[model samples]
Every structure is written in structure tokens, then in C-alpha cells.
Target: MKIATKKIAACAILALATGLFYQESARAAIPIQQWKASNGAQVYLVESHAIPMVDVQIDFDAGGRRDPADKAGLASVTAAQASSGVAARGAEPGLDENALGEAWADLGASFGGSAGSDRMSFGLRSLSEPGLLAKAAQLAARQLGEPAFPEAMWLRDRERMAASIRQANTRPSTLAGRAYAAAVYGSHPYGFEVTEATLARISVNDMKALHRSLVEPCRAKISIVGDVTRAQAQTLVNTLLSRLRLTVPARCAPLPPVAEVAPLAAADLRNIPFESAQAHVLMGQPGYKRTDPDFFALTVGNYILGGGGFVSRLSSEVREKRGLSYSVYSYFSPGLHAGAFTVGLQTRPDQARQAVEVVRQVIQTFVAGGPTDAELQAAKDNLIGGFALRIDSNRKLLDNVANIAWNKLPLDYLDSWTQQVEKVTVADIKAAFRAKLQPEKMVTVILGATP
Candidate 1:
């Protein structure tokens, strides 16, 4: 499945709101147990014996947003080579990282991670065997601290990234997302792309430097769910992550301030000739930051606008009323900084313009009058009342915790999520939305618009 630019945009944006809703059916307060590992890593453990599997993640602050201008792909390449067997380089260091990653994967476990705009993550899902868990975690920690970004592996990964870059040009949604990010995050690392030139410039040393400077115990938050106690989780994190001498003081960078983007007046149309019957359109601008006081209000407001699926105004105007599209939705993505507040739809190519107009009308109307109290109440009830299904599994809980860890949100953030949603009065939602999103200034990217 070749995911498009908008899909990637949606994926990246949705990850930020992973813990937006609270699952009240947790019955008992599923405490977010906190501890400091001896190695300086903060650990959050949720002991859930509900399942026979354990999900653990070691997240670091070394995401792509911190990549230096000279070496745009350093953080990304460092993240990619995290467990990809950095052993092709000559000697013991190479062998160590490769073996470490392999060993972690060998014990009936699956491993994966990604570097986002503000954080990088390494996750493991394994059978709930403490001994096996110990080995896997230890291996993960080694991969974290001792990554030897070998010349050969770095070159190979760069080539792979470049190949994907070449392919993205022919993908409408990919191009749209890149354009949107470039337009919104201008001159910031948030807009950086892993292009052929950028990837080529990223040397093995750049990756090494990034891993050395940023992948520290201090920048780490390890979350363990299923079959683990607070003490055991702490020991696991310490034993695995402590040996690395990571004394780099925290260097905090302020988020890229919200940019004043102009409307897409003359559409920068592009063709990615495909046989699919419909084209996808993604519109809007950078949304809210995770720590923004109005995050909850914007979220609830967006739910009423288009995030409520069939119940949303976008769906009502663009799909049900006008029959211009199959689906239309809008959402607020609160990230480490301000994320994208996007409104998107996929429609038959012939009706694309009409669909876009319908969406605009809905947004403009909502912006002018805001949601009525009836609409506001419905969104809160659905979002809050339906929160339980979100925490149904250990993996889900880990996702919530990982997002919180990435944003350094309050430990009780999840517990207070429903309340936050409830506290969003009609006025709160309107003020937050009006302050965060400007319908007139929003950028719209319509991929594969029909002639």
C-alpha cells in the first residue's frame, strides 16, 4: 500500500493526539507509576496483567526537529540506523550494535521505532517473560547508547531514503504534505526533508554525533506495560541504559512559532497520473502545541467542526448535503510544538473543486458563528463517553504513555483528559479555535485536481 502525502501527514499529526481521550472503563485507576532509573532515565510503568504480552518503549528527544541545518538528515539517519545492524563497519563496536539489535529481536519479540519532528522512539513487544524481557531491554539500551552509524549502513540507508524521495514526487498526497510543511515550517528543521541532496550530505559522523549528543539517559523516558512492577521496570531501564555516560545538559529549543501563511490563491497543482477514481485534498495550517493551554478546547471544537466523522459539519456540508465527496474530516494535531490542524477529503476528480468550496463554506460558517451549545455538548459526550475503548489493551496504553513522555505532559494527563474535554465550554472552544486557526490564511493543497 503506497501511502500518500496526506496519509503521512495524517499519521504524523494523529500520533500527537494519541492520548487525547480518556478511557473511563479502566474500572480502577490504572496508575501511571513513575520512577527514576539509576541511569537517569525516567520510567512510567502501568502494571496490567490483563494480557500475556509486554510492551516497552524507550523514547528520546533526538527527533528530526533538532537536526542541524548543515546536516538536515542527521537525526533521521541516526534514528533509522538505531537497530538496523550497524555491524558492516569494521570492528568490535560495529559487531556490538548489530548483535544487540538481533538479540533483542531473537527472543520472541518484535521491535520498531521512528524519529518524528521532536522525538525518537524504540519499542518492543514481547512475551511476558522477565528474563526474556530483561535481555530484550538490555539489547534495546545498547542499540540506544552504542549505535555505530557505520559508513556502509549509513550509505545504504541514505540510498533507500533517496529512493523513497524520488518516489514521493509521483505521489500526490506526499507532495501535498511536503508542500504544506515547507510552507508552514519555513526555514525550520520541522520543514526539513530527507531529499537526495540532503541525505547525501549526511555523513556517518553526523549520525554518530547526533546519537552521541542527544540519545542520553536524561533525554530518555522508558515506559513498560504488562507484567511489570515499578521496581522491576526501574531496574530494567537502569541496567539497560545506565552504562552510557550521557551527561549532556538538556538544551531546550523553543518550538517554531506559528507562521503567517498566505492562502493558496493560484493552486500549485500537480499531476500524479493514477487509475484511482478520486483525488485527495488536504487543507489548513499548523494547529496547537501539546502544552498550549487551549489544546483541549481546540480539540473539542475541531471535533464539532469535522473531527466528529459523520457527525461533523464538514461531512454534513461536503458529503451528505452536497454529495461532493465520500468523506470529509478536520482535526487538531497538538505536537511537541504546534502540529497541523487539518481538514481533508477524498472525492471524485470531477467534483474536487466543488468539494473544496463546500469544505471552505462549512469552515467559514463555523469560524463566524462557532458551534452551538447543542453541537458542543454532542462532541464532548461522544469524545468523553467513548474514551474507554481507547485504553482497551496494553499496546494502546503504551501509545498514550509514549505520547505523554514525548511531550513531557503531566503524569495525570490521561486521568484528566475527560475532564479537560468536559471543561471546554462553548466560549472556550470558540476562543481557542479563533486564536489558533485563521480560515482566510489557511493553505490548501489539492492533489490530482481534475482539469
Candidate 2:
């Protein structure tokens, strides 16, 4: 049986790797279907019969932002431990972590859970053959609703995580990140760090309680991509969420609102001394939320500013013209709330100040005048040309669908993405950047830099 399972798994993997399952061209228009599930879950599907496999992502409102400040990392550890084991249900026997792994392997499918800053997600991938998909969905539902949160397993994983945190603390990058987050986010939950003490505070009961309260069917947004019809996808979603034990009220209760990431009040600078030869510098401020109207403008503008790699103005100014650093980049991490807009680079400790000054000047100039006509044209052309790569595979399409579902974006968002990028004019970029970024109030963190 084991040998047979190994062969099946290998064949499934090979099929996926060789793109044998996908038949559609990358540039085809994606027709998205959206509906409300019987259990109040929002379901989004893109029926692609070209592939005989399915990719799914289920997202909930439970994530790091939901964690209590006193017990940071609760959502993360809860998500991790959900797959540790599943409790027995009547006639079915309980499965430990190892048993769970074996079961998924035998079916040539995979399911796992993770939590990011704004949402907790469970993802599953499997061949859509009737028997295989049924077994995979059932197993996933069981794991989702019946996690044991074994005390022994939690204790073991906690120790391992604590040790990893200790090792990370010794690195300059970690230290810089921690300081930068604290400086930028202030009292926001987004800045909460997972310390050894915080890990020690997380008990199995906490995981169970959090999972019980937040992982409700009503709060789920299910995104599916692959070779399944609407009826089949509906059934698959129902089965995948069947194990959730909580009864849904006629109307789901509103969760307590998390405070937004606050805008910086003043420029804050931290110069930490370390023994490293290269200095790490990070500077930024709260940008904007995913739902902001200026998203496309900000995105296109960021590309010209620093997100376009060596072609970006920041790179041209900081790396090529002055030769202060080999690389320098900036990005906007917009989420449910205003995420950070950061510029980062590494340079010789002695040259750190010069690099920092150059990056600052470049940003100030760009924010004031916006990109030139030529730069704006180039950014739009590059972004539009490369859009196909975003949805080239099942996994990537699933991610994009999930983003749409979570952010409440339009159903035609993916299809109209290039149009949005193309329509972003120099005036739009300038107005958006001027409204969102405040260079004078940005937070700066420099580690291993000389005074």
C-alpha cells in the first residue's frame, strides 16, 4: 500500500510540474463566478476545464491583527497547530500529525493553514478526480473543525519556536525590523512582536478558544480555481467546511474593530550599534489600505520610484549614479489597514549616511514633482506587459482570486488590471503620492552604522 501511494504521489507531482494539467493560454480572460454559500461563506470560482486539478484558498478574519496584545503570535500558533492532529469523530479514528501526513500523501493532495497580518487562510490542492477530491475535502474539513490542539504537541512546538526566536534576535536584520515596526506602527497590533514570553503565554486552550470563535463558516471567503463547474465547486466548498462545529446565527456578530495603523507624527531615527561590516537601513511610514481609491496610482508610482528594480529612480540614483549601495528598493504593503511604505538597503557602515541621504532626496523629489512623462510611460508599459505572469498558474490564480475576495475588489479586477495600470497618468501618481506619503515624518532605522 505504501509503495502504491508513493508512486501515485510521484505521478501527481510530475503531472503538475510538467504543466500537463493546464491547457489554457496565460492571456485568456478569467470569468469569475461569485455566490454566497448556504453557510454564509462567500464563494468565488474561476472554472477552468483545461486543468484536471483544483486549487482552493479559504480565508477568515482571524489573523495576527486579531491577536491580543498581551498574547502576541496567538493567531499564528493557532493556525500552525490546527494541522498537528484531528480528533476522532464517532466511527472515524483520530489521526496524529504523522497519520494526517500519511493520509494526505496517500491521496496525492495537500492542505495547510497559515495566518498573515490581516487574515488566516487554509489552502488545499488536489487532483479533481471524483474519489480523490472527495477524500481530500473530507480530510481537510475534519482537520479544520476537529483539531486536537494536543497539549504535548503545543509544548514541543513552543520550545522549538522560542529557540528560533532567540537565534533570530542575534541577527541585525531582525533587530532592525523589530525597531522599525515599533517605530512605525506604535501601539497598533501590526507592530506586536512574538517574544519567548508571548509564546510561553499561549496555551492549547487559547488556541482552541480562538479557533472556535473566529473560524466560523459565515466569515469564510472561499476562492477556487481549476477544472470544476459551479455545482461541483459548491459541493466541494460545502464538504470542505462541513466539519466546522459552531452554529451560525441568522446574522453573524460583528467582530471588535482593530485600530488602524496611525500616521507618523514626526520623524523618528534610531541608530543602533553592531559589529556588522554592512549597515542595514530602513525608512518608511504608513502608506494606505488595500481598499484605498489611489491603489493603482500608488502601485504604478511606486514602480517608477523604487519597485521597478534597477530601472527604478531610487536604484538609478542610489546604486548607479552615486555607487553608495548595490541595491535599494521601496514598496507599499497595503492590507486591511494602512500598511508600510518602506525603502531599504545595505551599504558599508561608513557609507550608510550617504546612502540614506541619497534615498531621501530621491523620494522627496519624486513625491514633489511625480515621475517625468518618459518614466511614467515606461512604468505603465512594464507593468502592463508583465501582467500575464501574475495569473499564469493555478496557484497564482487562486491567490489573485483570494485577494479579490478578501479586499472586496470588483469581480472583473483581474481582467481590468492592465487597463487600470495603463490609465494611471503622471498627475494621478503625483496626487496619490503627495496625499499618502509624508517624507518629513518618516521613520528611519539604521543598524551597524557609524555616527
Cα lDDT of all candidates, in order? Answer: 0.70, 0.90
In the range 1-451, model 1's lDDT, one tens digit per residue, is 1234234334433432453333342544667887665556778888866444567888877777777766676776777776665333344455544565455435656566678777788777665557667766655565666665667766776777888889887776777677766665557676777678777777777777777766777767888877677777667777667546655453233344434323334433333444456777877777767888888888888888998899988888888888888788887766666677788888888887888778777888887778999998899999887777667566678888877766678888878889889988988877777787677767676666777
Q: Which residue pairs collide, candidate 1?
A: 5-173, 5-174, 23-387
Listed per model in order, the count of residue pairs whose N, CA or C atoms clash below 3 Å is 3, 0
CA lDDT, candidate 1, residue 419: 84
TM-score of 2: 0.97
Question: What TM-score should be assigned to candidate 1?
Answer: 0.83
Clashes of 1: 3
Off by over 4 Å in 1: 1-25, 86-102, 248-279, 348-350
| Cα RMSD to the true fold for all candidates | 7.4, 1.5
lDDT of each residue in 1-451, candidate 2, tens digit only: 5476456656755665665344353565789999998888999999877656788999999999999898999999999999899999899999999999989888878999999999999999887888788989999999998998899999999999999999999999999999999999999988999999999998999999999999989889999998799999999999988988545552468999999998898999999999998999999999999999999999999999999999999999999998999999999999998999999999999999999888889999999999999999999899988886777677878889999999999999998899999899999999999999999899999999987
Per-model TM-score on C-alpha atoms: 0.83, 0.97
Error of 1 at 391 (Å): 1.1
lDDT of 2: 0.90
